[model samples]
Target: MGSVEVPSRHKALVYDSPGKISTKIEEIDTPKPGVGEVLVNLTHTGVCHSDMGVMCNSWAWLPAPTAQGQVGGHEGVGVVASLGPGTENSNVKVGDRVGIKWIASACGNCEPCLVGADANCTSAKISGYYTPGTFQQFALAPAHYVTPIPDSLASDMAAPMLCGGVTVYSALRKSGAKPGDWVVIPGAGGGLGHLALQIGARGMGFRMIGIDMGEKEQLVKDCGAEKFLNLANYSRDDEGTKKLVEDVKAITGGPGVAAVVVCTASNVAYAQGLSFLKFRGTLVCVGVPEGPSVPIATANPAAMLAQELRIVGSAVGNRQDAKETLDMAARGVVKTHFEVQPMDKLTEVFERMDKGKLQGRVVLDLSG
Candidate 1:
């Protein structure tokens, strides 16, 4: 990449108002790369559900620093088009097939970062949340924190791997289940859930049971899920929840699943997930409930103690996880099922996504 005079203006999608769903395409000044930064010409960016939550102001538990109205879309894949002064000191150079992930930058000296946990860094910048994200045609990324996407992977497919893929891939890896172990993935049809299903079952050799709606049976199975549970077909009544757990136990040979990862924000899913886990099994939490923190309605402390169950919470993954996600995608072991939507239709895309109508990921083509 060579230095070219940056134009004074560029197009950006702005979430103008809080409610009523408004996104305006306006001409904004092209931001200059700051020290230790590189400007990337974003080609493809994934429209994460969390971005929808931010635009609608529905995301709770996030510190005010992570709130939206800055810019949305964390998973961005593109070529480095500009580098700031002092950035050359780092190994990353211009024209790299790099990616901007959920974590834009982190202080490497932090205790968590020293232990390979960048996501927990005391000083962390999250793209599309904490910092200006990759929704525009050009966005600046920190050179030290940028992910080097392999040359073989397509930009459109590589975008989601930055956030959606890395988040779930890291969680699935933390499930403590080895080969042939049954792991249930609730909400297995959505972006993160679908990716988790594929990576856990196909890539990690775990026996996966996907729980979604009746309509997702084929798609979930197509993504390598060994079994499917339709939440729509079951009621919340005792018989319904009991039967669902029984079905999982039957499928997993009576001892039930080794672990359950609830990828949906529904408290019901998290509550029911524990029931399907065998004694000493783990129940992982990955979704943020709509409002605020509250104990799950169906959770029983006595039952948990009796079973010796483990409950864990996970957020976005780190740089190494991002690299492994891209590697899996590059090798074609993790196939991304997504569609490219032009920037203008982005509002409608968010609406449909909020309604839970989309079967696959919706990637935004910023160039359009």
Candidate 2:
């Protein structure tokens, strides 16, 4: 597949029409790697919540990215097949096991990117959104932005790190806590939350408290969380909520967690996440709640004043974070639990995802 003209066409799933949320398998021309680009033979691709948002166009502020016949996916793991001109500086070579991420490419000269915050680069291209993503047999990526996957890591385990893991790792960094700080991850049994628990607690040395259903106790605990708060068991009344808050503080030596990172795309989670924090605590929003722009429920001026709390939003991490994350994976510090599905079953996968039945993460078997 590298610099070989075996076929003029390849299989891909394209969103032929936006708003329809429909996908179809089609034979599309295999793309040639342009300048500073690389064509990869994709093996695995992680399905992200942001992909769901893209299907539905949840973020209205940004222009709708999917036009007719646009392909969708990011978080891809593959071997480099071809490199475009001027990509020598990217340090990528043919046959390298690499992963393509959400931030497809950034203009390094931009003010924000010059400061190492490439995610906010004004002229940034995003995989699965602005550009054709990785839900195909092969995809093209800018050499500079494609992440190098550790040789020891399986493609499945490395796929989700491109998005789910990167977002949480970046949020953990913004939380401003050190090796001994307490961090809470809401929806802890879900794909992003589970990985976050492992990376934040075991790998990064921040103690973790997982918030999810009672049935998820063992899963969360196994992921290195110190405690599990069953979201279903928590009270709905103000007094009961207060008691639940006290329990969190009591469990953490009476000062609550230092930071709460909401991994679920639920406004309720964000609201309750704030309640679990101690004074001067931080709340990092990694999830994009659906529908109209709803203000974070716990953002009360008085409560914020009393607690000296801070709330911040994290998009995704830069190249440095991706490198460190993959290095940790190489060291067996972070592990991803995933189910691999054939690209043909993508529609059914989305249906189950809409019903909240799929657990962990789903990685597409592009070659299949």
The TM-score leader among the candidates is 1
Residue 165 shift from truth in candidate 2, angstroms: 1.2
- For 67-182, candidate 2 gives per-residue lDDT tens digits of 76778888999888888899877789888888998888999999989999998899998888768888887899988888988888889889999888888888998998789998
Residue 216 of model 1: what lDDT? 73
lDDT of each: 0.83, 0.84
Number of backbone collisions per candidate = 0, 0
Regions of candidate 2 where Cα sits further than 4 Å from its true position: 1-6, 88-90, 235-240
Highest lDDT against the true fold, candidate: 2
lDDT of 2 at 363: 91
What's the lDDT for candidate 2?
0.84
TM-score per prediction, in order, is 0.95, 0.94
